[model samples]
Target: MKIRSVVLAAGLIGFSAVASASSFVGTTNAIGSILANTANALGDSTASTFGSDKVVLQAREDAASFVGSNGDLRGVNLEAALGHIRHQMPELQASDMQLAEAILAL
Candidate 1:
């Protein structure tokens, strides 16, 4: 009977350790998911704040495509995008090169 009790206690402790490990894994996964979600939310908010207008969005797309294809900022698409941005936002203080670089950065 004493041997049986010892065996049972050992079995229970082993099960408890497994359960604790499983719980720790679950908690870590949940925290990782939360952090990823928070980062995504922040990224989306920053993008919206930076280029909320259709013109800016189109320009960024154009510049990105231009840069991707030509590997430089001398494409017609980039030029057109810069022109459109300057036309739309006359108050923008950035130079044409600066605007093109910003669009590429986006």
Candidate 2:
């Protein structure tokens, strides 16, 4: 009976960890979707108003707002985008907005 209780407790602990991980993944995915939608909107608005040439700059501004003051870049593969942006605009800072804009450009 003790062995059975121990096994059940262990199973519950494992299940709890899995649930926590799943929740984290779900939250990350939701945030990513919001960021992507915002980026797309910025790109489309820029293309319509100022033209495609200005989209990158507009994207940067919009992305900055999306990231807020904290500039959290979690759940996004922003490093790769940052590399590309750095190549194009060497003076741009390695901020969350710049990274988001880079992804938007692609």
Candidate 3:
């Protein structure tokens, strides 16, 4: 009975972790879409007001600001940080969940 209880608890913990990761994925996707839209809008506005050259310059600056020395997203939560990070590092693996959790813990 004790063993069964332990197994059940472990299963529940796994399920909760999965659910949490799923929710984080959805939120991250939404945030990415929002950031893309914002960048697009900014580019459009800058191009319309200043000109194509200024928009190009702004894009270059943004790219530099988004990249980090380690080539990773320069923050605790990659998705949440978005434009603030020094690089564009997409969370592509399960290990990223650990990193995200660590960041949140801090």
lDDT of each: 0.62, 0.57, 0.45
Per-residue accuracy of model 2 over 1-106 as CA lDDT, tens digit each: 9999999999999999999999999999998887677667644533443344343444544455445654553332344434445666676444556356534544
Query: Which portions of model 3 show Cα errors greater than 4 Å?
Result: 48-51, 54-59, 62-106
Shift in Å, residue 85, candidate 1: 23
- Please give, for residues 1-106, the per-residue lDDT of candidate 3 as tens digits: 9999999999999999999999999999997685556545544433343343332333342233334232354432354433222133343222333323222222
Residue 77 error, candidate 1, Å: 37
RMSD of 3: 13.6
Model 1: colliding residue pairs: none
Q: In candidate 1, what residue range of length 10 has the lowest lDDT sum?
A: 38-47
- Expressed as tens digits, the lDDT of each residue in 1-106 for candidate 1 is 9999999999999999999999999999997685455435533533454466555566666655554554454556567766766676677666554555466444
Better of 1 and 3 by lDDT: 1
Segments in model 2 whose C-alpha atoms lie over 4 Å from true places? 47-69, 72-106
Comparing 1 and 3 on TM-score, the stronger one: 3
For every model shown, the clashing-pair count is 0, 0, 4
Q: How accurate is candidate 2 locally (lDDT)?
A: 0.57
